[model samples]
Target: MVVTRSETQTGAQTGAVQNSSEGWKQQPPYRTTEGDEGFEKKWTAHCHCGRVRYWLSRDGPLASKFCHCVDCQALHGAPFQWAAIFHKEDLRFESGAEGLAFYHAPDKSTTHRLPCKVSCAYCHAPIMDEGRNMVLMFPGIIKFSDAEHKKLFDPQCHIFYSQRVVDIHDGKPKWSKLDGKSELMKEVEREGSNTILGEPKNENMQD
Candidate 1:
């Protein structure tokens, strides 16, 4: 369900191209506020089961990064989590808000709390990490028309690299913990390079 710029050019164009002879109906933008005072480009996204749906106010995320923290790996069941940072206000859920589930980290409680992970209740698909100030939305769920549009959500850096189960050589800055607040890790050219140059080996790698 990719939405390209050309497809969203004009309302009349979108309405005309609504359905194909093959019975495939084009998905329109969740909402378009062209005449609004502070209108921004909107992007639509939904859960795997299509139960929960939402849209982003801006065309691009504020910040995007790969998180390699133990919590992220454990929750996502992946090597690392690619997250797109967005202000809470910019994200609007069009449906299934009540059908969404929350998982409070570390404690693993279901209580609605800030800095918690959100997912589709029925499909159990990871949605976003709701923080106090911002939300870290999973870019994988977002619809991109093309590679260029997808690149808008490309990760700027890697966080919690020290705890990563896998080494990423994308050349993005690797932070030992939080970006800016923690040590910036030196890059290793070799594939299995674990030890950081001139730094003590992290023997306490999380399993």
Candidate 2:
């Protein structure tokens, strides 16, 4: 989710092309057959401006949730965060590798987040999330056509919702607790600086 200044410019330039590609990738009208057993597949989710991109391919996602944490609300500038959970190996990012950034809010919990915040770094659209298998992606970024949006996501529960400003009276279940761990943090520690993929050094900030 890290969005730096320069990535913004490149993202804007490629947005149109990416959006056009999105039109074709929209999920099917009806849910297609799930991938075969033992089958592996990959899907891509990109920042609106396209500078930051990722691929998700592993065994199907373990679970997905729409988060309504205050951090999520502020990050998204929207009602909640839409995220899918997958094994760490399921996610990968390409492009603007240097522009990938990190932030830790001392006022908030000790959680450090990937770039893309402060103002929508990519789309300037007011929604971003930390990157890690644990961080959620904006469903909007999946580039699924409108038809796909209807089928692929209908978040079953909302997490960290006690912090949500609006009451989620839609009968949707709300979860307000979190286990303290940052997936990216663990990944970086294990991989160290010279990661197979470029890995940014851990920033020394109070979480």
Name the candidate that leads on TM-score. Answer: 1
- The per-prediction CA RMSD against the true structure, in angstroms, equals 14.1, 16.4
TM-score on alpha carbons, each prediction: 0.73, 0.49
Predicted candidate 2 versus true structure: per-residue lDDT over 64-126, tens digit per residue = 676655555555567666765544344445432223433333223222222223223445542
**What are the Cα lDDT values of the candidates?**
0.66, 0.41
Candidate 1 has an lDDT of 0.66
Model 1 error, position 68 (Å): 0.4
**After aligning candidate 2 to the native by TM-score, how far in Å is the CA of 41 from where it should be?**
5.4
The 10 consecutive residues of candidate 2 with the worst lDDT sum are: 24-33
| Prediction 1 TM-score vs. true | 0.73
Q: Model 1 segments beyond 4 Å from truth?
A: 1-41, 191-207
Clashes of each: 0, 8
Worst-scoring 10-residue span by lDDT in model 1: 2-11
Q: lDDT tens digits, residues 1-207, model 1?
A: 211112122111222321124221111121223333464547888889988888788889898988876667778899789998887667666642457787765345774544467899999999997654567889898888999999999999987777767666778888777777667876656756765322332422221
- In candidate 2, list every pair of residues with a backbone clash: 1-115, 1-116, 2-115, 2-116, 3-115, 3-116, 11-49, 26-145
